[model samples]
Target: QTDHYNLLKRSGRAKATTESEDKFLRVNSLRDRWLIEQQLQAQLNTGRSQQVSVSTVKRRLRAAGLTGRVTKKRLVWATKHRQWTTEDWKTVLWTDEIFGSSYRVFHSLQTWFVASTVSSLGL
Candidate 1:
């Protein structure tokens, strides 16, 4: 962004919109920010880039819609059952439901139920 742009040290003349700037650096990980800044500084030395800095690299990453966040993790409940007396069970419906996951990068989501109501599902 303009903020990062102002922080860069200008030194070259190569200013192509589709230059290697977009390809050579991508903030895909935590170390990527520093590494990208180092690489871009090297490019400036060889005149491949006009201005570059850590801030500029981060700005480019942000502009490219790249963001960082802690991954979500949770424990999945497995085979756990509740015990109830016959009189109590008479007022409750007992069943087991089976489900599968949905699309897009490994999610712990339960999609449509593949089986419902143990008896009808023949489980």
Candidate 2:
């Protein structure tokens, strides 16, 4: 008789999330890019006695190719510059590069973004 079993068919525990749940995660993640894993887990665990852990939510998001990042705040234009007339602005030269000493500021707020969006945002 031929052997019916194959070594490639290794068995293990199934995934905690279903296809629909994964879809829901992806949709909501895309809709709100700033939601943290804890927040996402709370949303998914609403009305359930057994709640999913934050790690699971994170793993699921990572599997979906989404990652968390710290969003950088853009430099705000000075109030004095807002009142500048076209003629006044003409005196200043605008270029992509900063010419003098500059300070870099970063915010600690955490947010999530897809891999493609992260690259596009230059984060």
Candidate 3:
């Protein structure tokens, strides 16, 4: 009898990226969470004739459990202190060392923030 399962398994086309390329993409993505798929694709395409699509880059990233999220706007502290005078500023405590995490979100015609996960970044 002819085996149908083996025949069925061999039907689809090969993936665009190889194992090494996928690993490179994942490592770069983890290293720089803000990198977009287009940029990643461009980097991957450099020095190679075979170019991968942005969607393919996105798919590879998604497979590695990375997703894009929009960063929420924080309350503007400067606005609250806008009316404060020199005397008011002197009354506040000043610290030479700052202890807090900071992540800058750049905005342009479109905004996209990429992170491994919401829980990972504690967002």
Q: Which ten residues in a row have the lowest lDDT in candidate 1?
A: 70-79
lDDT of 2: 0.70
Question: Against the hidden reference, what TM-scores do the models get?
Answer: 0.28, 0.53, 0.54
Q: Give residue 86's lDDT in candidate 2 (0 to 100).
A: 89
**Candidate 1: residue 82 lDDT (0-100):** 39
Best by lDDT: 3
Q: Which regions of candidate 3 are displaced past 4 Å?
A: 1-9, 70-105, 108-123
Estimate, for each residue in 14-81, the C-alpha lDDT of model 3 and write its tens digit.
98899999999988887876666778899999988888999998888778766654333323454567
Error of 1 at 20 (Å): 2.9
* Cα deviation of 2, candidate 2, in Å: 18
Best of the two (1, 2) by TM-score: 2
Give the lowest summed-lDDT range of ten residues in model 2: 101-110
- The list of candidate 1 runs beyond 4 A from truth reads 1-19, 27-49, 71-123
